[model samples]
Target: MAATMPAPAASGHNGRMLSTYPLLSSQIAFGLILAVGLYLFISERLRVDVTAMLILLALVLTGVLDSKQALSGFASEPAIIVAAVFVISGALAATGISERLGAWIGRAAGVHEWRTIAVVMPAVALLAAFTHHVMVTAMMLPLLLRHARDRQLPASRLLMPMSLAASLGTTLTLFSAPAFLLASDMLQRAGTDGLGIFSITPIGIALVLVGTSYMLGARWLLPKRSGTHGDDDYLRLDRYRTELLVVKDGRWTTRPLSELHKALGARFRLLGWLRDGVRRDDLTATSPLLAGDVLLVEASADELLSLHDDPGLDLNAIVRFNDTVSGEGAPQLVQAVVAPGSEFIGRSIRELDFARQFHAVIAGLWRREGDMADRLSDARLREGDLLVLYGRPSRFSDLAAHHGFLMLVPFAGEAKRRVHAPLALLILGVTILAAATEWLSAPLAFLMGAVAMVSTRCVDIQQAYRGIDVRIFVMIAGVIPLGIAMEQTGTADLLARGLSHMVAGWPALPILLVMFTAAALLTQVMSDAATTVLLGPVAISLARTLDLPPTPFVVCTALGAVVAFLTPIGHHGNLLILGPGQYRFGDFLRIGLPLTVVIALVSAWMARWLWLGGPLLPLSG
Candidate 1:
């Protein structure tokens, strides 16, 4: 029944009339309102996913798009591509490919910062240009974190640069990001030919060259944190001194240590025995403890707290007399920085109900430039601020994972289940084959890959859904209709006519540069795909008016849309690193501005030279 539904056509102006009338006026207005709404809601309180879904619902309700058309984006090729990319990335991560790659690069390049940056940045960039940057970030972040920790190199220096490289790299190939696919689809719908998979490679390679050069040079300009040596530096826990206590029921309270150890081995360890307050060094599993006996423990502060709450044991009297006792039974404490893209972003401790909600006591808050707040719950949490909380170990880990917060301390647990390398490679190969052979559409191929991952138990269905960013999916769906509405309303043509008149006498090169720069700048403020869809058609029209080849203009628009490197707000990858890198807004401006200029200049030159034949002037009327 769903498949039988009629395909919806755009109402109002047709393509021919759009060129003459006020084209895409409705679309522009709708897009602006939608964008503002998204920004406000996302900034204030609502989850991005919720906001996106609401927009989609509005579109369907308003008849801007039919239910089928509204849901089309979910089944679109780009969406599938993104989903498949996530799976491949997960498989690659599970197989430890990224870690092995980092280790190899580290060994080959030695410890010199520049050499390491050169080797790792290019490798990551190349991979990112061909796949999803999110996957690249997810796979590489942990590896780089571990590597930096191991080598005593400041993670602050590496994370941002690496994230930047991934963003830049995705600009190199048409299939590199979902934005490109969206652009390609828009172009096709606008009566322009779709771009080839590698059509943008020339300009993309140029951007990468210029961008990577800037990153390598900017490494010295970055701040270096003091502790960089591997896990030991971040995870040292000497402050925590744990001890155990036996339960005394006042009657029939004799139990052998062997029985307790066997029963609780998964949760606790009995280090030594105490009988009548005398310590016994030779305590074995079989040692018996009477009602008044105690057990000395050396475990994490979190572990000790967990045992304190166990129903079968009594730790109250023992904790009172233990020399390790701190304030009111609260154990050791440590400070940790909140990572970027963490669930804690835009959340207040009071809002999160830190104490009552998560059962943790807030101790202190630290920010880079702000004065320290006396109370943790009173401070408004921001990305990169360090938090000091008192809680059990398992509870902290749960909090970190639940909130997408990073553990500043080494994760002390068994590694998660991972997919085998060969199997993952096979799935990736099949996906590529499907895309290349056109045997299946890109979306279907990716969807199939996601299904394969789940069916094989390489990753669970729950994880597959989690792997896809539902917020991004909703944003794409809501925005895609706006593009269609733009085409339907004749706004795109009006904008193109205005631009053509403004650049009437300019050489093709400057006109092309202006269009590209406009797109690149707008991308910093809007979604890249939205920017491309709204602007690509206008760029194409401007080129046509000049009697210049449209290919160059299209390439420029696509390239510019993806090269949003000058600000954290420009791209998600940049935002992903903002917290972890401990970077300030100024840091992005300092490094990204120069990089953006270089990419813009190089991309324009490449488009002019390779496609436009030395910047042809507009045809005289």
Candidate 2:
């Protein structure tokens, strides 16, 4: 089952390695590759996708696996399902079905804070169960923020619950997250029936209830800060930092001052006018621009930086680095996470012209560690900083890019298109019914659904392509070979035999708990997909050694992989809310530790009852 992949990840050393080497045994090669992969994974040396491919390359070069076996994950059922789900999620967003559902839920919010949360949080959880949780969070993010503004409640109170609920939703369905899908893929590859669509849903119900109740009872622990989602506070903290530069060959030199104001005034705020380094108060709306004249205008740091890209006027920082400069860097703010390959990523607001470029204002920014309002104008942008971008209805499409940015707050009374919603809904519903009812294979059903989205024009092909998170796709595909290598090399059996001896006399409950706890802990430090990939084969081998069903062990491993409540880095959804909730790293510990414990206990308990029925009684009997 060889696979095709995105050119970037599939290229590099793989080309030469395809030629092969017979120098080492497959076991030696597998062990060496595993060691190096672990080092790269832990050291944060390269992107996880790159590291995965490197591991694949090692496996093939040393003959641990053929190229087809090494790259099989790209064509696996899990990969197809995961990639297809992203497109379906995008179609929902494009047609505004998810947004419309979120808005309807928002309307249920009353003046009472708890009541409002009661309505919003569970609805978010339910929605997440079917669609991708990150998209669910992204869809609901704006609704909750709007409710916070309309009711004058704390935005902080709403965001963390929404994020947590989205994460918890992963457990409720077979395909909500890659961890679950991978779990199913592993089981199927082992010659067992894969997970049913709602197989773990009972456990999900318990976890969701536990999380919701915990957030409500511990409301006092939630941050009370104004959701730093608005740029108004930043405006108060610092006045306009950028001054407009009119070059000798400027595009706007012949245009009237009023005309320029009317065009970009919504973005780059024009305070007044200046000439020859002097503030000119007498400049009227009808005043004509001059070749060398300067205007006192306000723009975001990134927007100012983006001005360098303009064909006309240039930020003088290039001409005179020290002349009237605020700071350096392309500081592009984020809405949810920066769209994965966004032009704005890694650039500071000062480095790009967000205001004029995107026709948006950075009202508030949320970083994982600190409040950004203090240095709002010059803060460097990262992938997961939830930026409050205030722009008009016209800019919504570009701001979010068809569901690329999850959990972004939108302008009040944001217009949504219902025209395409019915067709999108029908396509998604048909796909789910066909798969859930066993009329079609999950992968085929989802693939058809994704294709339907494009054919039906619910979302264009470009949008569908954009919706797939290549990092996740490549990471999963790259690592699948590790499992294959482990099985093919007899390493899993070796490790499994050893584990059986240590737990010879113990009931399976405690061992299950241990396995679950280990998975949960590892998920905190790495991507859940990686954790699941590393541990899943071991769970399978161990179950076989003990003469017990592998399903529960695998299920528990997946459950733990998905329960990443203990840290923000555990999941992208957590980082999505990190800034909006104004949470500290310590806050996750205080809030999520208990939830993690509860989920672990509930998951192991359920897995035992569902799959084991009794502890492993006669190991190797």
* Best model number under lDDT: 2
Candidate 2 segments exceeding 4 Å error: 1-25, 231-417, 614-621
Q: What lDDT tens digits, residue by residue, belong to model 1 across residues 534-598?
A: 67777767776788777677667866778757788887787766766677888888777777777
- After superposition, the stretches of candidate 1 with alpha carbons farther than 4 Å from their true spots are 1-69, 145-154, 224-419, 437-440, 548-551, 609-621
- Considering summed lDDT, which 10 consecutive residues are worst modelled in model 1? 410-419
lDDT values, one for every candidate? 0.63, 0.74
Model 1 alpha-carbon miss at residue 79, Å: 1.9
User: Among these predicted structures, which one has the highest TM-score?
Assistant: 2
